[model samples]
Target: MNGDKAPVRVWCDGCYDMVHFGHANSLRQAKAMGDYLVVGVHNDEEITKHKGPPVFTEEERYKMVRGIKWVDEVIEGAPYVTTLETLDKYDCQFCVHGDDITTTADGVDTYHIVKSAGRYKECQRTQGVSTTDLVGRMLLLTRGHQQRGDSEYKVERSRTESMSEDSAAKSPWTGVSQFLPTTQKIIQFSEGKEPKPGDKIVYVAGAFDLFHVGHLDFLEKARAQGDYLIVGLHTDPVVNQYKGANYPIMNLHERVLSVLACRYVSEVVIGAPYSVSKDMMDHFKVDLVVHGATPVATDVDGEDGDPYEEPKRRNKFMLLDSGNTMTTELLVQRIISNRLSFVERNQKKEAKEANLWKAMNADQEK
Candidate 1:
């Protein structure tokens, strides 16, 4: 009893997308407020209900949150309904939320339950940046950019040049490309050709370039919370539009292979113009949508006389922060900063190897 009482448990929720430093700071502060932190990740459907549309899918969001270092446990559910029932289920003595939610109309804030339980607290908002701010900045930086097209053209030309000599060579795997899936046969061997039903699918999407361990962990966690995990892969054009010109290092096909290889992922669907289509979700019978802790919720319809609200279905969304880890942008920056050193080291090694080969050939001739 004394041991249980010693560790204070806290509850926090958000649609953690992009999983940036601001989100990490928030989770760090939230964890400092209590001994144990249980995070809630909002599903895609719930996000659509509240905020317009999220950039990354629920799985991507979950992965981003789970990657955070401060998060102790992740709960896949809606963010808006931080109810007493949930608090009781988790045995949470304290509820934590950002100071920003203090004036919301839905008086049903996290502090309300914590105060009712006699242990409510508000964590400080991470200063400087947010997912929204980041997205806005990216939009500002990459708007009307033609660099992506140039990069794509360059990479394609290089690939063609490399393959020019092998044009007559037979393809390795029948007619299929190296990046394609193993087999088109969707039937399972053990189940004996049973038609797979589109069950209660949970959809999540993102670019997912430079796949990392955090990405894997999030997918595993999100898949456990649902029946099927449908990952939405952003096409090059879509990524260029949303993420800007200097984004998506790996092409769409490569990104798909990286995600498809994950055990938690079931199917990878390409994203449309923007946001996951409600029709696609309905067609797939998507029961829930999952996202990270810091996802940018755009397409707010409140000011335009549209029925859709800014943050849709606030109650049904779950915002999770599992742990903070590596990001693609950070990785790229590191590589760029060390480019000269890497090149010099590689050049030295190649010269040494060539000299040794020449010496060996001379000895063989003698």
Candidate 2:
């Protein structure tokens, strides 16, 4: 810790099950207060014990948090019980948490340990948004079968059943034989046509709220990786459900247009409630799922004593490690903090120009 260098250590922790703007904001603020921000992700057992079941698995949660811009490293363990030993391990100059959790149930002040250690501060919570609000809003908005009546659901089920029956009836072969391809030549041709170079296929999907250069670079790399690049814009409802309420600064349509305008993206696909599913991958046959090298992979201990085994299951996914880049959340914070100064500077310039014009007019009249 050289006096001339930046503060090298900071500690922050959260459930981080769904990466949202609020989470990003907190991380950015924490990082700004220090040089390196070490994030502790709540393990599945810990989250389940304190809160209800998390929408994402522990591994997924870890990956989402790691993907954030300010997160220097992710500790995959229970964060609920923070100890002096843990704080000392990182040689952290301070421990940061949202101000929203400053009070206890009886209104007694909390976070005494960090304070005693001469390192504690609360970052401002992004107002009017949270994970709970997002989930509740989604469940309330969607029209369920119970409210619409069972007949509608039943009717849809019957239609699907009838369609299957009709398709089976049209087949020339009887029984299971109808399911098999009539000619082996067609199957061979399809198999031979596998992923080839120059195929104009596109791939794009994420909670891309605050668009930044990293996103742009990733899209550019994705486009270069394929003949075409189709971005999957997550819908507002889906985004709210997956991410917390304090997410997606831009709405679904805005997000769509943002990606559409990008030179790399040729088309856009709306991502549903969660991660890209097998159905979507199969339908698009995306040769690559381009991602940045921000360590967006969850480490889980396996029988072989390797933590990296879990993320490897996504074989079709290609991890493209882009250089360290700024994120939209960080950009927003910088703007907000400097907004007043920026406004005042602009106003002063405008006044100066007006005064110069008035003096010039007076001189001309003289």
lDDT of each: 0.54, 0.54
Q: Which regions in candidate 1 have their CA more than 4 angstroms from the true location? A: 1-200, 297-316, 345-366
Query: lDDT of candidate 1 vs native?
Result: 0.54
TM-score of 2: 0.44
lDDT of 1 by residue, 70-171 (tens): 678888865555667777788887677765542112223434555676666776654433443333323333322222355654453344224323333221
Instruction: Provide C-alpha RMSD values for all models, in order.
Output: 20.6, 23.6
How much is the lDDT of residue 354 in candidate 2?
Answer: 40
Alpha-carbon runs more than 4 Å astray in model 2 = 1-3, 102-110, 142-366
How many residue pairs clash in each candidate at the backbone level? 44, 3
Best by TM-score: 2
lDDT per residue (tens digit) for residues 1-366 in model 2: 448986679899877754555566678788878788899887878765554455456875776666565678888884565657778887876789886542222323345677677778888765433444333223222222112246654453333224231322211111111011123312211112333566857565666764545676677677787786767766665555445444555555434434543445555665542355566766877666665654332221112232222223555566675563656555445444555443332233233334445555699999
